[model samples]
Target chain A: MNSDSLWEVFINACLINNFVLAYFLGICPFLGVSAKLETASRMGVAVCVVMLVSSICAYFIHRVLQALNAPYLQLIAFIVVIASTVQLVEMFIKKASPTLFRALGIFLPLITSNCAILGVALFQTNKGYDFIQSIVYAFGAGLGFMLALILMAGVREKLALARLPDTVEGTAISLMIAGVLSLSFMGFAGLG
Target chain B: MQPEKPIVIRKEVVRRGSADEFLKGLWRENPVFVQVLGMCPVLAVTNSAINALTMGLATAFVLLLSNLLVSCLRHYIPPQVRIATFILIIATFVTVVDYLIQAISLEIHKSLGAFISLIVVNCLILGRAEAFASRNSIGRSLLDALGMGAGFTFALLCMGGVREILGGGTLFGVALFADNYQPWVVMILPSGGFFTLGAWLLLFNRIKQRQQRKQPRLQARLQEMGSEQ
Candidate 1:
């Protein structure tokens, strides 16, 4: 409904306000699953898929909830939709390709709880973006989440070999790396 | 008569167990520093002391109520549908809280943004419900929720206090320094959240490592003293 262009929305969501780094939407999986690049990328793609589906579903659900004069149910509705959609995605992958499923099996269910997916739905609605804009925004957010994940995974791969204090070995070190990454991403501000 | 007597005696044990359940969440099994269960809001709303405290309390409220409800209904919920049921219950309570927060203070609500509603997905709340509440009694679940909630609130306070002090040169909106004092603005930014939490985790790990180191020495000293006696 807003007059913002699709490109601007995409750019804004992807870079200027990255879900993972800027907004800190999905730090759980961002830190948990970013240890290995292969799993991280696959997890990123799986999240992207779920995000897109939930975004579209949210757009329509918002319309319905508005029509019914029941806006209060939006949060509950959005979460239910997201959980079911993730279930559907899980099933589709399980049947389509057992290998890919094996790679992504565990992370798929976790995608339900990932704040980024729910964030996309909530933000798109809060911004009052039209259906097309919502989809673009979702895609952009997904891309941004994936980009951050892959980048972190790459850095962590090397960090594994670096000499570090025993105290700063695991999560503390990764969080520090993410902090630096977030600081760098600040440069992309105002691009849109 | 014998069973009744044992039940009375076990009541005292239950009270002591409740104390342990409540105390563990404050430090040992802290939801933030130790368990690191809910990181999204832990980092997102912790830009300031008030925001951090408010968000922490809000989450604790939800966790408490949901845990109570979940434990009360645990016997009735089927295993296969339990997760779904849990989500539904959590989502419902989250909605109630969402409205409650909005009514109480729009300003705070605005600051929290969608993260307020996002409480439904907070792994800490759901994690506690599924792991602790579902299996525990109502009284124990309440204590567990309180402890974890307090621990979570305490952690948020730690992060918020540090970030606000460094980032804005103030605590809870009161200026801590002169006008010329330069705030470490980075401490309040998105990256600052990561850095601050990481530093806290580092400190926690250091303390834990030191404790592990001393634990064996203390045991050895005790053994040596016993042998001498």
Candidate 2:
């Protein structure tokens, strides 16, 4: 908003430089919990919420670390904050929406370990984005992740009945689909 | 894997030894190729052989050190707080590694970037700490970490070697092909990373299937002989 175009930030993070397709930030849930479209979309939303929270938390934390001259605490602080935030999110989702909780299963809590969430925090800081830009970057990363997960889920749903070679029936086929999807995503590079 | 299988491996290792614990992750239970636990670093930093090697070594160091600590302090860490504690230990080591890489080579450190810090979320490391290290004895935990770490490193090397070769017609900066070789530029791009990993997975799957089929065919032939007799 200040200097860099916000739309470009969104597009670059969401498509041109997708967290999953380009950065390989959140492949775990992209491959594991992305079997069904509904679940995949929910997971995507959950990640979006978490990424937004963590990005804000990290932005403030970065300011503090800079003031204290203790930037080394960034990794440990970011992770602990993110992990506990994920726990809070998990409990909230559990009590607030049992159906969504059931759909999420272990993956809700597993968000603590999801690199994409942390990657958003790390990458935004590296890029030196301001508060507004950081939030946008985080949301864009979450959207890109959701986009990748949903696309992969759609393909995998069809793949369940497809006659695949026994060797490539499971993770291999998923990887192949992701590969193709990533290949197509490269076309967006020029758009951004 | 199946929940019951680890118990079976535990029983066999109790009687025979802990060698299988280390050997399994190398191939059978490979964290990357087989289990697919840590895909971010596996795919992201393997654009060059040297980068892959450095990233693998950095991860292995963290995995080994963190596993040792987790295993050593398993009992003191209540189940309620185990994951949090394990992560703290991992983050500490990752920070140390981040600085260490920077000290060694500014370029390598910059190249590795946040992915080095992202090692804390590798899942392979955390998965091992929770599943094997936190429950097993220290000696067994050490072996498990070494094996899984090596398996991850090996898988990275395989991907890196292929990507570097095809992407640039070089292996660790040595030209493999002729001077005029038209390098497949895709191999170095992000999509190339995904495609290369998928190819490796395909190759490993086929090899495993062939081995499985041979064993089944051999068993069928032996059954026929027995019936004839």
Candidate 3:
């Protein structure tokens, strides 16, 4: 693997191409948990933890799969590995810190299916990132996800007071807001 | 055990009524718009109108089938093991859809990719199964699933239409303008998703306020007639 600068990898992952905004991964939690800022922030941190661990685990697992010449097993294997890891993490958190667990407990299992986590693993494998790069990319992706969630949460919080129509009150409006955000992100297209 | 009270027994049946319960998912408690149960695919796959249609259809199919089967087998499956069973069933259908899409075209399949498989974890499907389908009949569950699926599809289509038009300067892959038309590339990006959705929210609120203003005037007129009566 070619050695890449950590800062370069970080900037690329976080800003130029975000997981939710650019890559279109982990949008489920981005919208579901983003209804409230408190929950969104907590979920963001939880997801960051999962992304870090999963990225490391997936990098090694991908190497093993490549050695075995069983790339077909990639998707299912990644999902199973992520699911079991989340389970273990959940149990550890439950036993270790009930308070932190309570704050982030419900979101832990949800991370197992978060497309962003798996997407990071897949992207890292495809891009052929080294160990350090994989970790940095994961960190950057998590930060990106957090950035989008926080911005959305802030806007949605203010939207709570707005009198939305009976027909298109919640999801429809949130989606339109997402459309505009997607538009603004275009300004960054020439950055890289 | 003490004899069951008639009111309590009836209350249980009322709560479990299939048709009313199922219909509720369409409007009063729409999984996408009203309840906001599933947001991942709603936001992610809706970049293009066609993608939105396919994703919405796929999700609806999963929701409908899973709800029916889960409701049918609710009695046999123990509560402790129900979630596992539910995931297994949902995953099986997702696998079927995944292969079917692959067979159709690599391009569309590539675009959708893992988001299709992730439908298994979409809170809307599982949430309904646990909360409604587990208790309702096959017929009621089907209607509930249909209603929610359509509602979700409608929402996705709306987002996709706006994004595709502004972002790509086209609709459903057809260019609306000539060579001079320069698409606002941001509309297709991540932040554009946020700002577009936010503006739509504001617009929806404004329309709602206008309607609310009209309602009070109409109510006042009705009250005047009532006073004469």
Candidate 4:
């Protein structure tokens, strides 16, 4: 719990090693749901919220597992916890705001299986981040995810009008774009 | 008079088309190239030839087994619970692969790490099972899985081959030239994965375009002959 530099944690999470671009976590939604900016932003916010809560929850869960000497169950338990938490969130959102629920829709449940949420938990536990650091890291990671999604959405929106062959019209092209984006991100490696 | 006018009609037989269904996955609806379903592992583990092969084989095993099992029990599985069932089956196979990898060698297992475990969450496996396997027979499901798996593997290997050559200045860990060859270290980095994949895709698109151009002339000539008929 040597808690000191929070900004470093944030910068590291957001840029030096982006969740989507660098780490390759949460790519499912990054590609699947990032067709529109609005949806991508909403998904980003939702993922950020889940990351924050899960990070806090996982801190406790990690401690509990350590106490019980059952670290092996961490992955399975974390998944179950995240899934149930998402279910609760979905029910709450549905009861509270129908419009928002519709916007988020299937992605809410999708958060249950999203690797980013679990990745954050696993990473935080592995890194042994303090509470403040964990929160900052989660926020930064969420922002990073949002940044990548927005950029991708912007590119994809324009790409719609561009001429593409039938063979590489869809997924193949998207992957190629991701590859280029990944290459650009490499330039930022020396920044940190 | 009406009773004497009764006519017997033959029912159209619905035969299962196995090979067509399976072969379609190779190019028509390739999991990686066409559907782009499983990009996570495609981009992540394809930094090297060995990793690409390992990931490909592991995914194929899971995909094949899950497809077979899901197809076999498709009728009994309620629609609502089908996804859960498919995931559980996938997770079981992933666990088996994970342990088997660990038992065999630590280095390769370490390289693969969470990606192997994350196979349970790979949408491609569940996507195939729910969309294709659940509807087709067990045999057909296996073929489809094999085809899709092969396509995915082929795509991964292509990516890996390009990345390893440029990124590491070697192929399959073998040094092709002398030590003077300085590899573009960036290729080995995360960004290299994107560049290699994108370039390869652009190449694939160009080839496909050439093929499309050649198809219309052939089609037009066939139409001219049909008019004569």
For model 4, the local distance difference test gives 0.81
DockQ of each candidate relative to the true complex: 0.92, 0.79, 0.40, 0.50
lDDT of 1 by residue, A33-77 (tens): 999999999999999999999999999999999999999899889
Taking all chains together, each candidate's TM-score versus the true structure is 0.96, 0.92, 0.75, 0.85
Tens-digit lDDT string for candidate 3 (B1-229): 3566887888888776645665666655766545656766766777888998989889999888899899899899899877667777777777677777889878998998677877766778878888878997788878888888887877778878999999898889999888788888766766565655556555655666788889999999999999999
Weakest ten-residue segment in model 4 chain B by summed lDDT: B7-16
Best by DockQ: 1
Name the candidate that leads on lDDT: 1
User: Candidate 3: deviation at residue B156, Å?
Assistant: 1.6
Candidate 3 lDDT, A1-192, residue by residue in tens? 756688888888887787777666777777688899999999998888889988999999998999999865665666667777788878888998899898986788778768788778877887889998999999999998998898889999999988865656666666666656656665666766
Better of 2 and 4 by DockQ: 2
> Which tens-of-lDDT digit does each residue in B1-229 have in candidate 2?
7899999988986865566888888999999988988999999999999999999999999999999999889889989888889999999999999999999999988888899999999999989999999888999889888998899999999999999999999999999998899999999999888889888988988998889989989999999999999
Alpha carbon deviation, residue B195, candidate 2 (Å): 1.3
Decreasing lDDT order of the candidates: 1, 2, 4, 3
Per residue, candidate 4 scores C-alpha lDDT tens digits across A66-168 of: 8999866676666667777787778888999999999897789888778888778877777789877888998899889888998999899899989975676
lDDT (Cα, 0-100) at B88 in candidate 4: 72
